[model samples]
Target: MADWNAGQYLKFEDERTRPSVDLLRRVPLSDPQSCADIGCGPGNSTELLVERFQNARVIGLDSSPAMLSKARERLPGLTFVEADIATWQPEERFDLIFANAVLQWVPDHPGLLARLVSFLKQGGCLAVQMPDNLDEPSHRLMEKVAHEGPWASRLTSASAAREKIGSFEDCYAWLQQAGCAIDLWQTTYVHPLEGAGAIIEWFKSTGLKPYLDLLAPEERVEYLRHYMEEIAKAYPAQADGKVLLRFPRRFFVAQRM
Candidate 1:
């Protein structure tokens, strides 16, 4: 099982919810009878699903026990389960499956997408949002630095492990082939935060997970410091004491035939 820090995951609940809310707004949920939130970290979006589908039985499924514990503590009445999205099977399927910022981690994008869509009832909706920033400088820099740096020898063994990342067109084509009417688009969220170090902190919670796990304790700190310095140079702060961060994300809403 992939280990994760509950405290660190839950800390970004509020920050994650901002984009989640925007994605949910585009969903055409008239009255879902049953809903599932895959990769429901800390139940941030799970709580929103509850309010949106009051009569529906909502289930929040995640692989992390720590995160599931936090979810249960925050919302006792709602259901939260420890399950991997790649292998999880619903007892009776769902009317709606809401997956926000989760698909990027799965190994088989096509297979995973097919499996999730198969669980949807006829006419049921599958709404998903994933980070499309793999092509951006933020992520590319990590790859560039890792492969060329002094620590490259240590990471060489794991270098072939590919992260499942796809383009908006790639997602749209896949969903269309699966026989779902798809609505796809890209949105760049410019989140303005206070001062320089805040962007580094934000990434530490979200984007730095994989890279951090690969480094030694001391090397991890040095890597982060070096990364922050590089990022700060490009995204200098304004006179008002804030930094504007452009985070590009892709959304796909597909309804079963």
Candidate 2:
């Protein structure tokens, strides 16, 4: 797949970063000495860390060069590393590890969560937020479109690029084994946007990337046309001509004991 498009991702920056704001609020740490923003796309969430923990040593980590470039420009004074969270072996642990809207793209939730926990010092926190919207119309439509077109053969395994986040019970047990006390919850944000096109623009930077990346340019156009048609049907326009994009996200702040 192609590298992430930071420009597209930032089009809805406020809505994209709102979960990070809420996730940061639940972190119990006070005056943490260090913080790492894992999968810190364009440094939006990392900026929040800098504002809240004024004196802490903060670093943003991401695998996408486009994202890392934008993040460095967004916060030039801070350090941002290009690294894959799946196999990152930090030289030292951190007082806080903040992962916002990134883990769902990674596989092995059990191993990933445990590895993140290992990077936290005792009493440190690991705050995470992932979109739990695989069952939603937007995503279901992606799979449906992928399978129904001539490009179906090329995208047969495309949907597997994103891992389905496990249940809360599954996460609680995993974090518990990692010796962390956990605080987990789920939130569904009904984001009001202009119209069906706005919804397409939103997912184009996210959930739709995997499928679109595999298709030819004309195929991608056709696929998106079908997707937009379904989206228009799934979400009706409100009295004000806005569509509400129902996004469900799961959040957890685990403190290593």
Among the numbered candidates, top lDDT falls to: 2
Models 1 onward score TM values of 0.92, 0.99
Clashing pairs in 2: none
Q: Which residue pairs clash in candidate 1?
A: none
Reference-based TM-score, model 2: 0.99
Residue-level lDDT tens digits of model 1 in 75-183? 9998888998989988887888999988777778877888899999998889988877766666666666677667877765442343556766778778888889988
Q: How accurate is candidate 2 locally (lDDT)?
A: 0.95
Candidate 2 residue 114 Cα shift, in angstroms, is 1.1
- Per-candidate local distance difference test: 0.79, 0.95
Off by over 4 Å in 2: none
Give stretches of model 1 more than 4 Å off: 156-164
* lDDT minimum window of 10 residues, candidate 2: 157-166
